[model samples]
Target: MQRWKINLSVLWLGCFLVSAGMTMITPFLSLYLQEDLGVEGEHNIALWAGLIFASNFITSFFFQPLWGKLSDRYGRKMMLLRSGFGMSIVMVLMGFAAAPWQLLLLRMLNGVISGYIPAAVSLVSASTPKERMGFALGTVQSGSIAGTILGPLLGGLMADHFGYRPIFYITGGLLFLASTLSWIMVKEKFDKKAAALSAKTSMLGNLKKLMRIPQLPALFSVTFLIQFAMLSPMALIPLFVARLHGTSEDLAFWSGFVSAATGLSNMIAAPLLGKLSDRIGSFRILVICLLGAGIMFVPQAFASSVPELLVYRFLLGCFIGGLTPTVNSLIRRYTPDSSVSQAFGFNSSSLALGNMIGPITGGALSGLIGIEGIFIVSAASLLLTSLWTYRSLRRAGMGAEGRTG
Candidate 1:
């Protein structure tokens, strides 16, 4: 196999492992606090769980660009390993946490070290042929979605049989195995001397330089809005599902199914849409998917039955699946080769920023506008973003059909 192909394959697995490891422990955290850590009272468990969960993204939002700069200076592969190993160790420590604060601190540290996915993106973008970049990024994205879909199911099963703390240990072991595989199999053509020469700009200097690229800021906004819109409705889905389901029995199952439905379709659509974008141009794909996803959300808001919502969620996934890979491809297309990692790092920050704030906003809005209103707001936001992205590309003189900037 060619070196780039080999690297893509391993990095895909690395992404899967990293995403799975992060998510697997998340579903059980509340239970862990209540059962294992002996947290009493509903309010306390909720507060502790929310804080511990958001702490990771809060730190991740601030730290991703720093790692991106380091990756550009050192090597993406090294950054990936650093994140993989760092997260693995931190995850294990969570299992040993005797108190909630320990777990919160560890989660914060885990967030600070979380860069495997972005680093993998940087590596693939740096190594893959430009002609195949869309497909490669899409494939990698599918791996992450697959992990996201499977992680909760697997974690729930393990937690039932093996208990919560052991789930952390198992997640850590899986991360270690993934990193070990990358260490042995993934090869980079990175030149340290050249990277050192290119990375002399301060992190702020790099950010300023990348922002001067006309299409990039819009691309970054689209990245942020994509995540923000999707995640905003995420935490409220179970209540929405319950309202539609009209029964408590199997409510959990239906909620899980609805959540996974989007990921399942997304995993299938990402690579397919990615390949399509390579032929038709990523800019066009971005606009269409954004519109498609936005339209799909409208139907979800009106869904009267669980099955209706599930179907809508699945359709939404098909469009949402295309957004991240296309955005990443576009980011790579617009960015200078020397600052690609830094650009992706900033893009990752946008994603982390959305992840951190989306749920809070959603929860806040759920009371004022109600759950259905949140979906309308999300849909509207996406449609506006699509228009903004279209105008941004037009002003930058990128034709809708242009394959490269």
Candidate 2:
């Protein structure tokens, strides 16, 4: 790889490793909680499982703004190092966890310390010229999406074969290499003036600056919706498969397949849409992708079989995949160079908050309503977001017209 390409690729791979490792644990966490930790009955296991999973995102949400600010201060490379090192240590510690509380605590700690994607986004944003940003960020985002596919398949196999213990060790091992490569490969043109511009403790000040940017409020709402829609399926996918597919073994295979399918589609679509957005504009691309995702969601609820479900997921993933990169591109357009990391940080926080909410809420909705309700909820959210995005673009078009007139 070219030096810059290697820097982006390896850092993205590091993100993929950590994300894959963390996500790979999800389908099995409750089972592990009850069986390994010896929780008192199903109810306690259920509650603890929720806490364990939610804690990571909650911690991420609390720290993302801070991490984003720190990335601005310390350098993107420093943030990746911080994330890789932190996740690696915590992931290994989790393998040694003796109790539910211990595992949950470590997961939370993992969240607080992890900073890879934010740092990577900052690096890409700062490095890529404005015209090429959509393609650059989209290509980078695809790695995380690719990890979503590979992590679960490989992780499921690892969990089934070597057991959960090995999963943590393997994840930690990958992370160690990722961290090492990031340290060696990724370099920023560190400016003494940029270093001096760092406000290490002024995360709130940075957030305030981001908040004042034009259309940020609307963009933030759209961000929340995009995440909320994506994570609804993610939160209870394993369980959904169990409920919808034939057997537990069937669930495992189908669950892994669906996760990977989305990643595959996303891997293909994100960059293409992002490149198209570069030609068209982020706002227009966002609407197109969001609406396409919404249309794809309809078939998911009505799929008669596992194969059908997979097909629908693959198609939907094509569109849903592009939504995130489009949003990132739009954010970059509005953000000043000084606070780019902070803006991405808030965007990261939105996803974390949604992940924390989406799973628990989806699970609850599945229980109280039906499995199909998840699709309905996700589709509705995406539809609303698509409309908002379209309106925003139309208004901007008129704004240009008025400026000329």
Candidate 3:
């Protein structure tokens, strides 16, 4: 690999580690809250869990754009190091939590200081040539998916043998290692003249500037719909599987299998779709990915057995796998180099908002309409978003053939 690629790969590793560190304990967290923390009450587990996850995103959402701006003003490598350090500390703190509320507080802290993906994204985008950009980012993103795929399995196994604190302790150490990696590697250019723009421009002006790009709405809308649909499959999978006679042994096995299936497919497809976007255009890939996601997720609601559910989940993973790279490609294609980080910061916010709503919506719908029906809502939303995306972009004459910027 080229030196720049190697640098990004290092940063990419950090991104994955951080992602894994945060998500690794998710499977057993509810149990820990209810059993260990003595968090027994009406809505306490649900409320605490919501706050725990939501805290991270709330911090992330407010800080995301700010981090992007800081990165633009300072540098990506430094932010990478900073985020790793912050995340490590928070993860360690999480291991010592005495209550579910403590965990929620720490999760908030995690999000506020953590912006690994955004920072790593800035590094990759700034460093890579336009021709190699898509593949590079797809690869970086795949690391994150890989983390998600491996996290639960590792968490489960480790939790049985080592317990939750040990898992967090190890993840904390890995996060510290990731911080070191960024500090030692990952280099990028600093433009002297352009550094003054963000300070000169107000926040509203900056946001307005980002929004003016004609494709921004299209990209943002698709992001929301996909994220909304995507959360259901993830949040409810364990519960859904349990309802279908899944066992403890089966939990890790199925979680690992399904998570691996999605990650494996994303690992295979992300770079391929990214490379395709370079040749065929982002929206073309976007439409197909979205439509396929809608179709695939529908089957999950209909799944009756573990094997059947995994198969549908695998298919859903395949399609959802391709979506992020497509989003990154679209953002890269339209946004200027000067403002890419800021644009992505806002992009991060959109995802955070989606992240905010997705689980709650999915959880609520599943509870109200029944578990299988959630996929119906997911499918209909995805299809509508896909059709909307295609129509809007086509009417504006946006397609795969026009990109070279």
The per-prediction tally of clashing pairs is 0, 0, 1
Candidate 3 lDDT at 310 equals 73
Instruction: Please identify which of the two predictions, 1 or 2, would achieve the higher TM-score against the true structure.
Output: 2
Q: TM-score for all predictions?
A: 0.78, 0.81, 0.83
Off by over 4 Å in 3: 1-9, 38-51, 124-142, 184-199, 275-281, 334-341, 399-405
Ranking by TM-score: 3, 2, 1
Q: How far is candidate 3 from the true structure (C-alpha RMSD, Å)?
A: 3.8
- CA lDDT of every candidate: 0.81, 0.73, 0.73
Give candidate 3's whole-model lDDT: 0.73
Can you list the residue pairs that collide in candidate 2? none
lDDT of 3 by residue, 1-405 (tens): 787788777977887887777677766665567667887742345445545655677778787767767877877777787888988988998889998778878988888888887778768887898998888887887677778777776776777676667778899999998888777776677774688664556777877887888887677767777777776445555556656645655454454455456666666667677777677677778888889988987777777887887787667767776787788767776788988756766776788888767766655555467657777888888899889988887665576443431
Clashes of 3: 1
Instruction: Please report how far candidate 3 places residue 203 from its true position, in Å.
Output: 3.6
Q: Candidate 1: give the clashing pairs.
A: none
Q: What residue runs in model 1 are displaced by over 4 Å at the alpha carbon?
A: 1-12, 25-52, 69-78, 95-103, 119-142, 159-165, 180-199, 242-254, 275-281, 302-305, 336-339, 399-405
